[model samples]
Target: MGSDNSTLSSDVITLNHGVQQYFIPSCEKNRKIKIIATPNPSKGLVNINFENWDDIELSLSVFDALGKLILNTKLNTRNTQLNLSDLSSGIYIISIDNHCGGASSFKLILNSN
Candidate 1:
């Protein structure tokens, strides 16, 4: 049996057998936006907080389990409240995107009792 030697670079991998694999690394390492949501399993109302978001234009969107758009709006403050009481109990996705190329998402659970 022969030995296998491989090398890896910042964005590529090379095998001793003359094979190369290339890939692009994610650029989100320097993302300046952070978010947190409270009362995950909420009945209808939820509060969200933002961090490191100084004068950054960000947009918030909420989508249901079926990939339907539940809410979409621009965030104008570091803290905001969302009224989901009208929505049914289920798992939803909250996504925030910074027009400057940063984006993040969170999973929210709604419970009806």
Candidate 2:
């Protein structure tokens, strides 16, 4: 898995953001992965959806305003969902990482009743 086979695969191309490197894992080359949040402004509860993937290992987490992980879990398939009704009212960041090679970060704002 450590070998560089990208040069041999016509469909594989390297992608990067500034100084960060992005690549599709060798094990999940044919799969797709995505993450999303609903009700940008969340109140007692929230629904997070991780969509589209043939085979992936995903992680979803909620962080407090200070960037501390208060809730987290691992998901390994499509249409994964997360419930965030136990978190206290405040601004939180939701991070989804396909440990295989994809990741996305977003914010969730929680308000009091």
1-113 in candidate 2: lDDT tens per residue? 57543422223222222111122322366654444445557665554554455555667777899988788888765454455667777888777666555666666677755
Q: Clash number for model 2?
A: 0
What is candidate 1's lDDT per residue for 1-90, written digit by digit as tens? 978665555422222343322221123454445465777778888887766666555788999999999999998798899999999999
In order, candidate lDDTs are: 0.70, 0.57
Worst 10 residues of 1 by lDDT: 18-27
What is the Cα-based TM-score of model 1? Answer: 0.70
**Local error of candidate 2 at 101, Å?**
3.1
- For all predictions, the C-alpha RMSD in Å is 12.4, 11.7
Native-referenced Cα lDDT, model 1: 0.70
Report clash pairs, candidate 1: none
Number of backbone clashes in candidate 1: 0
